[model samples]
Target: MLTRAEDGLENLWDSRRAAGMSEPEKLLCRSNLLGSDKRITNYGGGNTSAKVMETDPLTGAQVEVLWVKGSGGDVGSIRMDGFATLYMDKLRALKGVYRGPEHEDEMVGYLPHCTFNLNPRAASIDTPLHAYVPHRHVDHMHPDAIIAIAASRDSRALTAEIFGDEIGWLPWKRPGYELGLWLEQFCRDNPEAKGVVLESHGLFTWADDAGDCYALTLDVINRAMAWFGQKTHGTEAFGGPVRTSLEPRARAAVAARLMPAIRGFVSGGQHMVGHFTDAPEVLEFVNARDMARLAALGTSCPDHFLRTKIRPLVVDFDPAAPDVDAVLGGLKASVEAYRDDYAAYYGRCRRAVSPPMRDPNAVVYLVPGVGMITFARDKATARISGEFYVNAINVMRGADAVSEYRGLPEQEAFDIEYWLLEEAKLQRMPKPKSLAGRVALVTGGAGGIGAATAERLLREGACVVLADIDGDAVAEVGKGLAAGHSADVVRTVTMDVTDEDAVAAAFDRAAVAFGGIDILVSNAGIASSAPVEETTLAMWNRNMDILSTGYFIASREAFRLLQRQGMGGAVVFVGSKNALAASPNAAAYCTAKASELHLARCLALEGAEKGIRVNVVNPDAVLRGSRIWSGEWLDQRASTYGTDKEGLEEMYRNRSMLKRSVFPEDIAEAIYFLASDLSAKSTGNIINVDAGNKDAFTR
Candidate 1:
């Protein structure tokens, strides 16, 4: 493990500095690898930089440039532009700080001009410190293993005992101008201090040669692990009698508790992918002893606190027990105290703008063996915290043996935890609901899938104008939906998505209906499966015209309307998973879907400049009861599955890992989530409804 870790670190570090590497490509690659695992860094947690030689425009000489990670990028998914370039000489020049008139303002102007794009990206507030690192390839990470050891009792003593004098440990320091000065001098003083361990926080390693820098990180993790393992022994803190299962009743109860917040957050427009796990780890944390002892005990490496808040809600054992209410009440009360404390800490250290309100997402369970629980806007952060908790608990056990785990000082941890610059780094893709309060002219509203998607958006507070080629039939369908909600909530339009004039009329009617356009769900058309050779031109155009073009015309009008409104909107082309995973007789059907897919992407980028959000939903096989299944179709599916009607229904749907079929409502729910603020920062993203078919989909 040590060797593998060391090798990976070395390769990543040295690859950037390698002569063969393209600078922009190396910057993005570095960010991608560092962003992949929370064990390495939390959400937007780490920064990577490369010192490259560039020509001075006026001086006509070679100079060093520092391309550091940019703000608003998730390292896991940053692109080439995510690296902001700074003139190394300018950064170095700033080191000679003098209180003068043009000092700060001059710095800001130079800061932007130094970028690869002349555009300004928020610089890491720690720019001075990163710029000053002697190494060309420098990385900073808040690794769990290191932090666990750092937080333990006797951490400083244990660190000294483990590393001898080669390691330099710094007391927690405020991480901006002063910290930058301290780090520069410390590196100067301890020329042999291979790695710097910031007490209670993280580690910093650099390499004049990137490979050496990366190697030291692994070496540090290994050393920290060894010290931690020796510190805690024979305590089966994580391993236990094993939880047979979570309370089945608890699922519904917890779901109930989580629902309101989810609903309020989504505001009833988008459906939440919720239902929590009392997974063994979650249960273990909940039932552990001394849970909720202090909120900090189980926090996700401090950085995560920026998004999911700082601590989780630690429910008690026998969570259903009435007494649990009293405990929960206390937890809520503690929230104010935590918020007040964090805000106060911000005020004490902050010299600039105020920070966002403080709240924690991690909570320790009171049960001796119970673990912790965390919540996130999406499944990703929750999973990050879960992994962090597992590794942390191990570190905690280790610390118990070596000495108590020492963590960052509360305020310093809070500063990093609530660091506004870091928090603001998350690139929030504009959520697509810019169409909310708008009218959409869906081409195939009478159809199951189109109707389902329309329902999803209507629930999102958008006014929908349901249109279909089968005008009369769709009018009736829209009438039915309107009755269920409000007649005005849905207006029926009789226009074929395939007909140009009709498509225009429908848009006109929508504009008349809703007074403006906000969101668009362009789902309309038919599909006929046939072999490529057997497919006729006529068959291809029929499907392409009625389905893909109909969607196009509707989308085209929606795009125009969205443009006129001067606000962004989300327009989801109902694409099929067949586009990615081909089927036997889907050649022509496939091409049209592929065309719409590309169209959505092109528009996503183009509309991005317009504040418009565009994306496509490629749902796998959808077998819902709306309009897709006529009596004959149902009978055929039932007979093919060798089951009775009910069994065939379940068989058709319950084949996914989640053991559920792709329902029209499910598609609607997923689309609603994507169209709302939940996916505000998620333009150009495709969501697959396929449940774990390895060939199924992509993120």
Candidate 2:
């Protein structure tokens, strides 16, 4: 057993754990262990494989099969189905039909024919690299320490010096069938080698036994880390910090201000979700004197640049004297210049067969004092892209510390970026949902209609911020929704809509959490049942305070963010049928609801110039799952109808012209229609979900 290196990787292989496992299970265990540490491999950045003897379905005979991590799978979270299975003989047979390098992409087309047992999971491009290696198990990982050496100026010489003939080195080659053949040739040429390093790529280690492969992979990475640590000890990173970092709160404030503006500039094609990280390493690099020079060199690993783009746009912001206004003033020009530069790069690097230039916007943005901001079509992708960039930063730190760092050549990077295979994979992806890039803030989100609306929007791919006065209840609702959808798209805030400061802060949080809000479901409310003569001053004010004043406060905040984002948005108010038809003994509720409806119209008129749409969905007697109906409102309404609480829903149903009961889901459907682009041309419109109430009819 190897002892753990100080601040280096640990040998996580366990003999006991592997004692009773099958070869495939052992491969899985090895992969999870290697992938658990970002120091070992980033999310979805590496592949692992094993050759196992399996029963042939057709002939009931034993056969060799290759089981490798499937396309678009993360090793740490992968399951059995995540591995693509292929017949070893059939994979070997591919070489006979393989053409030269120019026709390499067509080889991927033949991979499906090599499928073992009709496994539907698609094989990754790295499939051949593992298939051609004459070993029972193989591991390919992009560990920062290993990539540091791989990306160094003297990477080939450094590999020989460190491993001393035990590991070999190969020059940069884009991953495909041709590279796989090169690796096979390397293994045969250096029979005693434990593994080989692919320059500007990653590490690949293999052994006949799964445990040995796992141990060897860890050992190689740990040795690289130890070497880098010794060489770089007490050295200045990125030529030392030129700017100090802002305090955490101040950093957040700066990010909150910059993200919406940056998001606006980049989100021309589709709305982008933003992620912010002020990790120590990110701050170190962004604040350094060599930051721009190093960042402009771009990332070394294909996995890094594929997500982060060729390079990040470093924003001009000073930490000592933060002129955020100056930065904001020049942001448009800076962004446009970056886009122009990218187009020029594409123009210079394009081959006759290269795909057309994609979105010209930058994916990663670096602000010296604030942090790193990454934007993508959705929140999870934005977050992952930031993580990959952090890996690139670590690689740069180590490589620059020892030997000069080198990114991939522009032509090579461009080929990989616009590779036809990658384009095909992207084309295979399912269409995005209707609200795929939208962010929504739902008030009273713990209540029935509010939760339903949130759920509806979430299903259509909107990231939702659930804001409510009941913190615990809202948290529970958010948690439940996060379980169904991912936690990345669901956030909860404790908010009292009547509190102006609280409302503003919630909007800021939403901006920080999801770039900015694209939809505001103004549904926070309170219902009071009292006769005009019996209504106390406090009761009337309470109704007006939450219903009328609260709507104004939330809408005002949403409008501010939407205007800042420069993206038109949707605002759907959850009004009451009482707004149109007077209900006996509920004068305060009726009046406040009426005020809410008119406020929607007024805001719609004001917001139309900016492309912001304001609409309302009026619901009547939606008792199921309603928080309002769980309290005094239910008893009061039952009393007014001279019936028990059990009969209230039925009475309301009978009262409607259609004799159909309205539920929170029914109202949610109306709200969704108003909030999505289906109602893009609609503003100042009222959608009544009151089961054909003649009094509430708009026409």
The TM-score leader among the candidates is 2
Supply the global lDDT for candidate 1: 0.60
TM-score of each: 0.55, 0.98
Worst 10 residues of 2 by lDDT: 1-10
Q: After superposition, how far is residue 160 of candidate 1 from its true place, in Å?
A: 2.1
Our tally of clashes for model 1 stands at 52
Instruction: State, as a TM-score between 0 and 1, how close model 2 is to the true structure.
Output: 0.98
lDDT of 2: 0.93
**In candidate 1, where is summed lDDT lowest over 10 consecutive residues?**
266-275
lDDT of 2 by residue, 100-133 (tens): 9989989999999999999999999999999999
Superposed Cα RMSD, model 2 = 1.4
lDDT for 158 in candidate 2 is: 88
